[model samples]
Target: MKEKKEKWYKRLEMPDAFVIIFSIVLLAAVLSYLIPAGTFVREEVDGVTRVIPGSYTYVESNPANVLDLFVSIQKGMIDTANIIFLILIVGGIVKIIEYTGAIDAGINVLIQKTKGRYMVLITLVALTFGILASMGLVANAVIAFVPIGIALARNLKLDAIIGVSMIYLGYYAGMVAGIFDPVVLVFAQTIAELPLFSGMTLRVFIFIGMILSVIIFTNRYAKKVKNDPSKSILGNRPFNDDEGITNIEPPKFTVLHGINLLIFVGYLGFFIWGAFTRSWGINELVGVFLMMGFTVGFVSRISPNKFVKIFIEGARGITYGALVVGLARAVVIILENSQILDTIVNATLVPLQAMPTYIGGLMLFVFNLLFNFLVTSGTGQAAIVMPLMVPITDVIGITRQTGVLAFILGDGITNIVAPTSGVLMAVLAVGGVKWTDWLKFVWPILLSWIVIGTLALLYALVTGYGPY
Candidate 1:
């Protein structure tokens, strides 16, 4: 009956992220009653909570009732409040920039400026946006850039799908590559009890490689489509003029647009500086974007009331992702409060203790890949998985840094193909590409990531990459 129901459910569309996460929270609560209750000693390290090994002990089973399950979602939101608000501020900034016509205007100038150098345009845009995404500042925010990319591709006689891939793939790669992505990197590292941003050197190289692969893939597809239109993934599916491409003259490059572009680009520079030199956290990151939103709105002469409306709408649009992050937290809360997380870890790890180190690390990488399809939010993935895996890796002699690496790699690679990934589907819809076409096009890249990542994990294990 359970298998039949799951198959029937699979035939239906995925539920809301919140619903899926909440269900997992309930399932975890149920497991607490079924599994023996246990915990590890914990202590503060660098102002973060960490489980102390060799402290595992059986505890009284404290099962949650239905009421406790219902309230854990609220607790989830409260715990993830910092990240949830950070997402809102960033969303508002992107929305106001869209309202200002700056995003379109800047892309218009880019198309005009880079005309006839289609490869240059693809490489430049992909790498630039990829870098921004790597910093965790501008990944989902690229939704607004999708139409602009399609417009540029159509005008250049390239496939609309290539245009969308340019943004989505680059961001996805950077996200998984995890160079300077504060949200995932900080969450995973802190949970694993590694120094913040440890193992940056290896990640930077991997980041460059992934960015380059996207550039190559996008450029190749773009060139093929440029040479033959019928071969385009978007064949015969007519795109509307307002979808961004038209016979009308592209918007003129004006002084106001130029200043707005400078401000946008200049702010990125300022952000990078602050991030590296000043050790900026969530608060500083949010403040910078808040200022960017107001500055762009004021400079473009958007009325304060209209600006307020846009900001609210922007925040509202991203509320789903923000809330899902918190609701996902409830899963962790349920497992922790039940006092059985360490038992799950130890029971699983003790059996694998004798395995070769590289294989053990690869197992983690593979586990993260499978786990990511279910929990798509990077923050949430870290919140639940990292704590369980951290001690297991220590017991098995795999470094915490390697564990975090596997988690991110596994998490990122699957998002490209997972139907459960809201962002992937959302990006495809914005680009007018079908998920079927995307899957066919993306399989090679995904396979390459798996191979490369497994090798990287083995290397990290052999080298004992650490700040442990």
Candidate 2:
């Protein structure tokens, strides 16, 4: 026992995303041997496929053999190929921007504009990110901009965590609020047959609460670091407070840099237009970002070969994150191939029918929280769980809108820690923050959010706040 305790694994080493995800895939394969296999019939709901209520059935065991387990990794990669490409493109674009020194020049201008009042800068940055993240289409797109937050933090003389938290938690808080999210909010409400964006007042309040919570939490940390640089967890490393650009003389805020930033803002407008009106998905986003890199590269006057070199370097840097996403998808594939995902869903949700209405609803939220580890995709979560949940809410004297609320709360909030989240892996990669460190920093606030989420769901249960 002593030797085991002393082992590095036992002492606790934070496994990187690849290890964590591959381990999950292995666990899913093992579960296939123990859990009964089942399937759910899916039907077209408003041109979208959805699981049919009351259509679950046990099937003959299809235990995932070794061959199937190995095959799943490749299949999983293929299934999420679009997301993988988008990740690579985002990495490339970020690198291209960096090569041009546009970020440093932009921050120089921002520093002059803000006049070192970091409270105003941090709050404004957090709110801007929160608003953008509230739009589901822009959420993943926001990952490419993580470096800017770090730059802003460095310029403000704060640590990396402070800058990242401003973007990560700020966006995440808005995401969990599910205010205008098409995937987790509208899609969930649609499955539950509630009006689009129903329960607006309560969610609006929750949204505000979330934004404020993130801002307050981030501000506190920023202050701690400001008061004593030694207080930052990241200070333990070969910490450089200069953010790598402090030595650049004269703080070059050239007109060319302004045009480059303007071009970026214009591209953001185009990108937002595409996401909203064109129903742009991963491929469209990849194309837009790739082109944006080229446009900005030329505007910043980087030579073609050098631009390509830096862009490739950036994309190469995030290969691990992209791979993590594909590997994480393997967990779903193994479970689906073995038919245990449906079985697990059935096993978890079927029991809610027997519990008291409020207790059942709360457990439903709990189940979604735990299940998010497996189905990390918000749209995928809504598809699999909503069919199970919407019908239960109807039969259990709970409002369907309440059911949607519980689901978004559970699925959305857990994204930060769930190793399966592609954005989580990607951000962790680019931000250079270990997953363990991120968890340590956020868990207190995360726990508070969980408490808030529970209360919100309980209120929904008590008030039956719904138009349905």
| Candidate 2 runs further than 4 Å off | 1-12, 135-137, 235-250
Judged by TM-score, which candidate is best?
A: 2
Query: TM-score per candidate, in order?
Result: 0.69, 0.91
Q: Write the per-residue lDDT of candidate 1 for residues 26-82, one digit (tens) a residue.
A: 888999889999877777656656556566788899988888898887887797676
- Residues forming the 10-long window of minimal summed lDDT in candidate 1: 238-247
What's the CA RMSD for each of the models? 6.6, 3.0
What C-alpha lDDT values do all the predictions have?
0.73, 0.79
For model 2, how does the per-residue alpha-carbon lDDT over 335-391 read when each residue is reduced to its tens digit? Answer: 888888988888889889988998899998999999998888888888888988987
Pairs with backbone N, CA or C atoms under 3 Å apart (clashes), candidate 2: none
